[model samples]
Target: MTRRITVAGVSKFFYLYENHSNKLKSTLTNLARLRMRKRRKFWALQDLDFTVDQGEVLGIVGRNGSGKSTLLKILSRITVPSKGRIEMFGRVNTLLEVGTGFHPELTGRENVFLNGSILGMSRSEIKSKFDEIVTFAEVEAFLDTPIKHFSSGMFVRLAFSVAAHLEPDILIVDEVLAVGDQQFQMKCLQKMEEAMSQGRTVLFVSHDMRAIRRLCKRVLFLDQGRIVHDGPQEEVIAMYLQSFEDLAHIPFPDSESRQGSGALRFENLALIGSDGVPRDEVAAGSDTILRMRYRCLSHLQNVIFSLTISSLTGQILFRCISTVELDSPFSVSKDGVVDCRFPRLNLNVGGYLVEIEASANGVLADRVREAMRLQVVKGAYYEGALPNRQSQVLVDYSWQINPDGA
Candidate 1:
């Protein structure tokens, strides 16, 4: 297959300013200064080189400020790179934000045609696919309505529909799929799969590792505006997760303020591994534990504590509960600390969350929303098999084979 997209020696840099004057304006002024300060060059992407073959789907994963969005913008021609060159052989459709080229005063119908034209679609071509776009977006009722009046959900639907159905040779998507509900997200994923089957090239950027693993054959990990790792889906994701120590250790002011609410107050939470040492890292498919030490402030019974793991993209992989599956509820008197183990963690390689929630007397007593973040380091665990326990809810499967001399 011929290479459809080539990013050669790409480097993007911006100036981050330092100070601002006014109080309310100070924030805005500071942000502006942050964007334009001299002597402070922030590299959003540097020395990045990659090639996407025709019909290939590539996933870019990184934290905020890692240049994933910048790279997408450069590729989509929304922004020019400070350095480097990108070669594209075909038309590219991008859904970087909810309303990229929309005119607020224009009706949905007009904007669809306008956005489609901007994406290189002819008027006749857009008209031929007009109903399909509206139907997929489910915005028939608001088609004639001005886009400014549409809700965020409606805008997302219409925008995604225009980007997807136009059949551009290369599709570049950022986190726009995250704006809608679960059903719409699933629909978008399905549409991407359909596009893949049709042999279109896809460049996908997402913080959701699951979507990346499910959709892309290759992955790239960026850190501080540089492509740190690029390879197979699993390997790249694993490397990315292992690199989260920089995040977990960044001290938050008054850490106690972030504690979960419950009869028991969380004293400390740390990710520990077989080494039995407190670590900000853990290997995938390894024996790891989220050791959360909590002290009961008062006598409590029939209390349940749970931890939920989610990708940064807001995908929940699995949740662990102490009381339900363990089938044991105990009373805590006065003050004491207990650690719960999440054995053989089977999460795909990515940054995950360890949320703490507790219920007492059949009601929610205390809970912390996304209390802690964890990263799953890649190891030689899966070999070729899928991670364990993923069979139940995360993915569906089927198999086919042709027997010879039947």
Candidate 2:
């Protein structure tokens, strides 16, 4: 057996300039005043070391800005590492972003050949796999259309199909699957599984833990550009979940990653128990409340509050909207608190995330993702033992049996 990929002390640093004028000035100044320029150094990845054996599926998991994308970009040779070295043994293809390696002016059919050529495939080879790619992408009807005219889903489908059918020895996929529809995502996963069966090496990066658990035997947990954990799948995921226990209340104003109109902003979010006590952990099948405090900068009309509960791996378990679920539309003119109470949270024992959003007149006012962290403990959901991890929810039902003769 051979090592398909080896990364030793890999680190990537990027310099951020205050403005384009400053960047030009820094370049003009050369080494004279370079140290005195208004530039900041940011490390997207630092000291990452790992290896993947031939035909092994490796999953990388982390929060946003944890350097998963930076490592993948390095692996794909899109950028050079500032510190260390990486060795890849075979031909590689990457599905990093939507429409990557595609020409907006060219038709889908033309871009397929273009991308294939960029991947080092000969004309004959691309022709041989052309029909298979189109079929897999399910874009034959729009194959002749310009890529710019295709929807995001269509673009990703065709891009993934080309990468998957090119038969590269190593496939590197980022979170691009999130852009496609669920059915197409499943198809892409099946294709990756097929590639793995053929003894092809794979490096998968995704926030979806269920997919990572299903596809990869080994996992790497990254935090702030460093490899925090590298081992079995379950253990790494458990460690990742445990890291969230300390994140009780998150202030939204401090988060620059949020996006929405400036009409309303979430100030803080917390998970509380029935006793109105802020807690990070709650017993399974127990009452839990999600308290969201927001400040309205101006008068709002027909405002609705939306909440989503998701697993740590980014699987959305359930969602509740005040307008849709409760058939209630409310307005806010000042700062206040909104509480979404769950009488008996039926989620199986695990860690989950609460996402908050505010909308008015079908337009988004504000949204904060992963606003609060919640942990579920073992409780009286069942008579004997609680349900397994495979079960998403627990339901209490009585069993009835009658004799045939009766």
Candidate 3:
């Protein structure tokens, strides 16, 4: 396979200032002051080495400060790395945050031409795909209007259409796709899949596990600006999520990591299986129970408890709220345990995170992220094998042909 992207010992660092004045001071400071400024510098990315083969869809995942964006910026040539080097084989286009490449003052149509020109496409080449871009965006009616007037959804649609249709050999997509509606997002995904099919290399970064799992078979998990895991998508995702497994069991509510009011606190979190035992492992089609223990120092009214199940990539799969599910809030002055049951936890085989949050009278009382790690092993979620890699949710159904004797 051909190497489309090569990142060799690439690292980036930015100076952190207390305020705007401090930043300006550091910039104009003499070498002596610059030495002191070095102490306040922040390393956004560390030595990163990786290569992307032609036509490979690479997924990058990490927490907000894990340097995903910085890496992409370096790859797209938007910024220079502090050290190391990178080589790419083709033109790079980016769908970064909303309002990245296009000028807000320019009309949608004008921005389309400007972006095409910036991508090194001739005027005729851009015009050839102009109608296609506008139609795909579904903003033909407002093509002449300044994009500043476009809603976020419209902007994303237009941006994705342009980036995907511009015929760039490489596309670097950020999490901006979340700004679009579901249908548009799916359309963009299909367009990207098509691009990859024809040998375009894509570097995708998203917190949405479903999208990453769908587009990229290989993934790179970053932590603290370093490559922590680089391998097949599923395996890397599982390892990334389980990185918190060791800390999930840490004593909760009392742990300094959690954030919430001091009114009510989560004491312990337990997952009970069908066989009347506690287990971290659950089958895909098996019944599961989440039991949360909490305590309060004084009388609490309208105490709302919530349990959330999310994928390794932070996509919220299910949420069970007390007031919404039970139709009434619990008035608790003493410690107790709350239970939420899932008759058939229809999740695909993978590692998941269980979270807990509680509020009293609209005030956030306690919140814990990744309170525990739950592993969903393979099970009979349906009569046959699982539907596909993208089918995270399993359902029981039957397919019949000629049932009506047509």
Candidate 4:
């Protein structure tokens, strides 16, 4: 099959701030007397190579300022590449930024045709699909209202509706989906899936890993304007999420005096592997250790402390409290620090937060909301029947396929 979109060694450079002129004071000083500002080059894209077959949905995942938007802009022809080559075989419709091609002065109804024409759609073609676009966006009430009066949400809704329904062979989407509500985002996802099933090509850039994993068979991981990984969805997303987790940890302050609830305060929380040295990063499916130190005020009895391990979504994966076992209740004296250690962490490849909570006599007590977040980075995983807390839960069981089919 011939490739529908081919990007070979694509490189895009941009000036940090182009076309600088002192307007108010300089206009009277004479046009020729104005000082020309020197321009500095910034490379938004570098030697990027990828080919999309006739019917492929490619997902791009990266953090903010990763140049994902710049790549999409280059593909949409809104910006030209500084040094690279690209070939497109069919009509391309892009939903790049918020209200990229919409005319604020024109009514929503009028802008649809204007955008369609800009995408090379015929007037009759747009006319036949006009109502459908308005209905899909659910902006019929504001169709006659000028786009300048519409809210940001309304503008993006109408813009996406126009771009998606134009029937372009290749569709490019950036983070613009974030403008819609959850239900609308799902609707757009379904539409993209339908388009993919019909053999249309799509290039999606989003920070949402779940959407990327669900829609695309392959993904590209971008870092600082360069492609670091391009492969299966699982692998690429894993790499990107790992990189994110590594960077999530902010350096602890040097001051030993940390503020917290006066009743109880946590002094330090650190990640220590089997080696006992402090570590900021840990591999997934490994024996890791979490150590926390805290000071208690006023001697308390029947004190139960709980540790919660959670993902970025606030889903609790592992929980351990002193009350799980009735054998005894943990107690701490007044004005002294205590330590708690959790060994053998079994988490998949992702970032997790360790939160500590303490209560007395079954009453509400103090807790650290997001005390520390850890990144579980690795490829290997243990799969078995376990409580489906999150996507991957390990029961730590081993099975073998015997000839008797056990």
Candidate 5:
């Protein structure tokens, strides 16, 4: 495949100021206080070097502050890089902030052409695709109505449709698949696949692991404005998620970081193996017990205890709830322990985070988000096979292959 885009030694930094007075002062002292200004600078992207090839799909994954959006903005020409150079061999289109140029007063039909033209489509081209766009967006009845009157979902649908129908050589999508309902999301994914089949290069930035795996062949993992890992999709995604293994886990209740009402608080968490002993690392495919001790700050009624096992990236893999709407709820008024036992931990070897929550009378009493870590080690998940790669889950199944000549 031919190279479609090349980013070499690129970096972007922003000036940080305490207030308007400081900002004006810094601007005035610009060249005179160059060294001082450098100290007050925040680098969003630093020394980024990569290339996207035609017909290739690349995934960029990272934490919230890891510079993914900044990089995308630079690539889309929405902003300029503070340092280094970028080379593009083809037309580039961005889906960042899907409805960036939308006008509230413009009718949906008018806005579609406006957005299409902004995305590099000609008036004739937009005319040719008008029906398809409105049909896909499912806003036929509101075609002549102002977009401001449309619901949020309807607006997003039209915006995404106009942008997606374009035939740009390179597409940059940033967390846009997370919009709309499930069916709409699936349609967006299908459109992406169609674009790929037409030999267009794609740069996707998303936290949806399933979508990332389904579309991208390779990935780039960013951390603190730097490219921490760039490799195959599975390897880079797993490495990025596992990087949260060593976070400082405070077992006891802390008032500073947790969220929720002060009615109930979690005090500690313990993981016990099948041998009746507590341990930090759990063996995959073994029986396990999670014990959480909570303190009641006040009297509580119809309290519900919930525990979730999630990948280090905060994607929930398994959850245990005390009861459902039909089941009886617990009524507690004192500090107690909640135990959630598993017959066999069907999780692949990786690092996972645990979240515990308690609710009283259907209101959130206390919740600890990613408060603890669970490390799963190597174990016998299959009869005679030991896997080398890591995934968030493991399942029991059998496979049979038929002879080709039969």
Candidate 6:
């Protein structure tokens, strides 16, 4: 089989300057100082070798700054590699960013034709597909309005619709689909599936493991600008997720990113089983507790602590809020621990993330994303059987039926 895309020893290097002044200074200093410079060279991708068959759908997964976007940009030809080579055998279309390849001043209607031309489509071809694109995007009402006026969701919908309908042989998609609502995201996923069914090659990058598992047969896991694992989707995703198993409890200040007023910040986070023992693994149908230790820098009133349970892919599955769930106005005047106990955690066997948020008087005090990780194992849920991954949560219910002649 012919390889549709071949990336061999591809590496991209970028220089980091402190500021505009530093960038200018570095340029001048390099000229006079010969080898002395303050700028730092960062490798976005390094020695990445991969090939895609004529009709393969490949998924790329990594944490932030993992070179996923850098690899995609190189593949899409948006940027040149500092070293190595790439060979592509078909017309390529890319959706690497929000409103990519779009003219903000042009109306949505005009951009469709413009994008089609860029994709090597004739005017007649674009005209024939114009209606379908607009209908699929559901942006007919704003067809003539400049894209600058469109919201992020609208931009994503229209941009994805055009790229998917342009009939390119190779499509490269980034994580931009997260900008749209769930319905539109699903629509885009379905369209990608349809394109794959038609024998088109796709390179998809997403944090959504479920979507990746559903679409791609192979996966590439990148870390620190290198391909750490590249193989079957299930194996790669499992390896990628298992790497985070050690982060059972994370200190708030040591978190990579955080937001809020900082009046109150979480000190630590942990997951405990029914026996109140800190454990990363919990039974599917057993009770579990999420404990958050926090300190109040100042007196705060009407503070609510909320915890959100999300899948490994970052989809929020369930949320518990102190104000809403407990029906009590929470306040913090000193250091304490807030425990969110679930009577029965029905999540199937999988890895999940916990996010914590603290707010005071309707103002955000502190928030942490993916503060903790937990793994659910086989338990008494669904007659002691593990539910399929497709089912987000397992629910207990009873069914009743009436006889025909009751």
Best by lDDT: 5
Candidate 1 residue-wise lDDT, 1-406, digit = tens: 9889999999988776565233676567658777533347778788999999999999998876688888988998878998889899987888776556889899999999999887778999999999999999999999888988887568777887888786888888885554455577689889889998989998888766667878998998888888888899989877876665454444333344344345666545667664454445555544567765566777888877788877676777677788767768767666554566755556655676677766766666556656677766443234212344443222333566768835
lDDT of each: 0.73, 0.79, 0.78, 0.71, 0.81, 0.80
Model 2: CA > 4 A from native: 18-35, 149-152, 249-324, 327-406
TM-score of each: 0.61, 0.63, 0.65, 0.59, 0.65, 0.63
Order the candidate numbers by lDDT, best to worst.
5, 6, 2, 3, 1, 4
lDDT of 6 by residue, 1-406 (tens): 7789989999989998655364667777788878655578988888999999989999998866789888888888888999999999988888775444689999999999887777667899989999998999889999999988986567667877877786778989886554355567678778878999989899998766667888999999998899999999989988877654445334555545799888998887877665455544666776778888898877899988888889989999988888786667776799888898887788888888888999999999888987877787654454334447788688888577888957
Stronger candidate by lDDT (2 vs 6): 6
Candidate 4, residue 159: the lDDT equals: 76
Error of 4 at 50 (Å): 1.5
Write model 3 residue lDDT over 369-394, tens digit each, in one string: 97877787554455212446577767
| lDDT of candidate 2 over 167-225, digit per residue (tens) | 88888988555435546767777877888899989899876565787789999999999
lDDT of 4 at 43: 81
Candidate 5 regions with alpha-carbon error over 4 angstroms: 20-39, 248-406
Q: Whole-model lDDT for model 5 versus the true structure?
A: 0.81
Q: What digit string (tens of lDDT, one per residue) describes model 5 on residues 50-153? A: 99888889999886679999999999998999998999888888888677688989999889988888888999999999999999999999999998898767
Please give the lDDT score at residue 83 for candidate 4: 91
Candidate 1: which pairs clash?
16-34, 17-33, 17-34, 17-37, 22-26, 44-225, 261-366
List model 4 lDDT by residue over 1-406, tens digit each. Answer: 8689989999888776565665766555554677544579888789999999888889997765678989998999988999989999997888765445777899998999888887778999999999998999889999889988986567667777777775778989875554455466677778777878888888998655666777899999888789999999998877876774464344334333333344655555666543343445554443466665656767767877777887788888788776775578867676443445544346765678878776766654566767787775432233111233356444456567799867
Clashes of each: 7, 0, 0, 0, 0, 0
Model 6, total clashes? 0
Candidate 4 residue pairs in clash (backbone atoms < 3 Å): none
Better of 1 and 2 by lDDT: 2
Give lDDT for model 3.
0.78
What's model 2's TM-score?
0.63
